[model samples]
Target chain A: MPLPAPSPNPNPAPPDAGMSRRSFLRTSAVLTTGLAALAASLKPLLEMNDFPTMERFLQKYYKEMTPEDMEKVLKRIEAEVEKQYGIRPHVRDLKPMDGVEFVYCLNLTRCIGCRKCVHACVAENNQSRNPEIQYIRVLRLPHGSLDIEKAEHNYAPESVPEKGYFYMPVQCQQCKNPPCVKVCPIHATWQETDGITVIDYDWCIGCRYCEAACPYWARRFNFTKPSIPKERLNPDMAYLGNRPRRQGVMEKCHFCIQRTRVGRYPACLEVCPTGARKFGNILDPNSEVSYILKNKRVFIQLKEELGTSPRFFYYFDV
Target chain B: MLRLVLCTQPRSSLVAFGGSARMRPVEGDALTRAGDPMNSQTRTTLVLTGLILAFLALTTLFISNLPGRPLRQPPIPLVNTNFLDTATVRRSYADLVRAGEDLSDFDCYACHEKGKPPPLRYDTNQNLIVPKEHSDIVMGHGSHGRNNNCFNCHNETNLELLQTRDGHEVKFADSPSLCGSCHGPTYRDWEAGAHGRISGFWDRSLGAAERKACVNCHNPHSPHFPSRPPAPGPHPLRPVATASVEPGPNH
Candidate 1:
């Protein structure tokens, strides 16, 4: 433009300068590669994501967080969910009540293979509808056969009571010695005092160690970001229970902790058509579950083996 | 050409370094490439590391804050009820136990005053308790072809009350006692809260539970429980081979 800056020579090296074209080009290649490799390694730190990344990274383990910290974190989560789904969730860290160890009992004879409990659980728990995350899988077993493997989960027919079949709905056993809790690398999951196992959704790295550890196949992982419509979202939520989970988290039934911790019946028990399901505090001698355990021929899924000591009991009437 | 390029880089730097050992700018460039991961002092490396660290922090923040799409709830399917028939009863215990709650208050004499009643016997099918006068009252309970006489379970004297096997008068609400006379072990299990269904508070301290009586789940006319359509089965996650004749050893 002005004096026409001297054109920078594209190939500056000459054979007379005692430098080869190979040397000149080689230097350029190393510098470019070195810069790129460094950038590639930094991708994890540099990549953008949707969660409150910095805050999540520095978050303390659930057991270690103070009550004040918990309240603050809850507010932050509420804000995040609101921004994303347009529904402001009431997330609470509900504590277990005194002298209440919850127990569940199901009467196999009365169950008519109706899958109402399974659907009720899904709606109440904010379970992912697509890719269908169901917490309860009712096994339709042949008559006189207690083997769960022989049971068919996909036996939906034109009608039920297909002659020789008895139904047993399987869910998270809430085991006293839960293997899922022991296998969690991030301590994202643990047992509550009320005998319900719960997970901190934000803290789970989605490694799926807990899923493999569970004998009941009771856990589900969010492969993609959950897409709950704003209209149907259950705003009433317990932090460890049915709060809308984000992407890359593991979840399962928590016995409707959001409801049961407050002395309300679980959704599954409420929707049972045949009254096949029962739930109560084990400590209370007069509770229905205790009555079933004491008077009925109560059995567990894996009693002698696995030593999981499940709070769930399955029994057929005498 | 590729081999020449690969082989020449280090040699160029070496020769360039040797030729310009006293040159400050040339020495500075060499030091930077060597300084990374060794001494954390070079300005470019420090700046780049800081940028990388910040980028990571920003990345984590972005991911954690990304909007999660809310899942649309799958439309709940209404179960076909006509097929369910007698095999299932959706009503709770109190609702069923309260079947004929005002039995003591009801007077059957209002409809059937001291008049000549129709013949209590069916010609061939014992279950057809339908008197010609009450053609709408079609009884199907005699499906077993036995116990067709009206007075078999009912009291001849009282039209409003049921009679137990011991000839004792029983209220309609207390049908379990009459049913228990024949089903002894069933009654025992029912009393122990086993055979039928129980709903409401499990803790009696909270509220009294309602237990279903025998008649609540069975049609008295046709005692043989008819098969009905079940509630929708679980959504198949994969091809279920377990439905075959046998999948594993019987537990």
Candidate 2:
């Protein structure tokens, strides 16, 4: 090159000595290095998907949320679910009924292995359309045997009542010493003053601890998102009973706490054709249940060995 | 002289500048010699001082937060016997009478096992029909053995029977309390959410809805009573079979 440019002075003056090219290069280099380091450090944090935090921000627990907050949260949840599942879910608040109580009686003698209650419960509770997740199970057992291995529920319609077969509908026994309540780690489930056990859906961590402790096999977990369409959803919902549930929480029969406590009968009880299901206040003397107990004999319950002390009872004419 | 040049830079450099060089030795030489020991001693002292200060601070914090005195146990409320008094029991009996109910047939032992007639007479009135010896008849009821009796459930209510407006005799109270008499364990369980009906609802604000009673699910008299079947489902009609053993042989 034309007489190599005079060797530039190595030491550059400060910025105060008029803007210089050397100073420009030094400042730009420092700035570039700092930006690179910052971008590298922040990459991992920015990439992380905080759906749970987003969900919390979008919707708060019913207890923590005000009425206005709940309305906004409900709409947000409905929208979020629609985006995820391609279906909008209807969410409502289910409050406990006043004064009324619900009880269930199963006639082991008359049941003919008909699973009407199971289907009825699914429809009533708005459960997902999965065969394994039924609330009620009508067990087909031998007439004189109590062994669970001897029981079978896999019968075709024509195979029902084949010779000496009897039907036993096993549901949540609602034990006086409910083992499920004792095993919950987070206190997500508890007994109400009205003698019903309930679960807090949000507090549940999906650990499935209560599911193992229940003797009645009455509890069911939501493996996948529930699929009730927004338009078809039942607007009336209860905190402990038939509100739509999320994926991975333990739920069971509350004896229709929402219905019975409000002077209404449970769906299963209402549908039983033989009038086999009876519910009332054990406190009331004139109720029909009291009269029957006075008149009838030969009543029994399942698994008295575990000392669960279930509220449900069964009797036969003998 | 040749040796002297090498020696001059070495040995002579020290001696040539005697006092000034000696002063340098006093300054630089002594500092170099004592540097490691002084540094080590200072480090050890600093570490020990810090540890002691930290421990003292922690102990002071703990002691300052401790309670001044031991906690005292709470006082227990005195038990009242007014409800159990004989006079109160008489007044309750009078109230039952005013309700048009008879007082003679309402004793605890009357319908219970020890009574001449069990409190709830379904068929025949036999003394001690369900004998106290046969107390272990049901699940939760039998757990307390014979030590528990009707008063456990009847509580302070007078056992005197009363006649209803319809000219029917009945207990002063209702079933749950009446049954709760001897079955104290189950009664407590029921009161605290153990042995009773539990119903769920979908809608809560529609006023009143039809609900089942405890007796509807349980039979208090029998204890472990089974629920009856729903009204029977519709059955398929069957063809009539006619008797037709031809009279051909007779003709």
DockQ of predictions, in order shown:
0.16, 0.02
TM-score of chain A of each: 0.84, 0.71
Error of 1 at A93 (Å): 2.9
C-alpha-based local distance difference test score of model 1: 0.70
Q: For residues B116-165, what per-residue lDDT tens digits would candidate 1 score against the true structure?
A: 44346666544555666556443555545566666556666776667876
**Model 2 regions more than 4 Å off:** A1-101, A159-161, A228-233, B1-251
Q: Mind giving the per-residue lDDT tens digits that candidate 2 earns over B75-192? A: 3221122211111102233346567877654555545444243343222422223455446444233433432344333332343443332334445544545445445665554453
Give candidate 1 misplaced runs (Cα > 4 Å).
A1-49, A53-60, A74-90, B1-5, B8-111, B114-118, B125-143, B150-156, B204-216, B223-228, B231-243, B246-251
Interface RMSD of each: 8.7, 27.2
Tens-place lDDT per residue, model 1, A12-116, is: 444444444544444454454555556655655554456466776687788889999898888987887788778888999889888999998888877877677
Quote the lDDT for A84 in model 2.
56
Recovered fraction of real interface contacts per model: 0.27, 0.01
- How well docked is model 1, in DockQ terms? 0.16
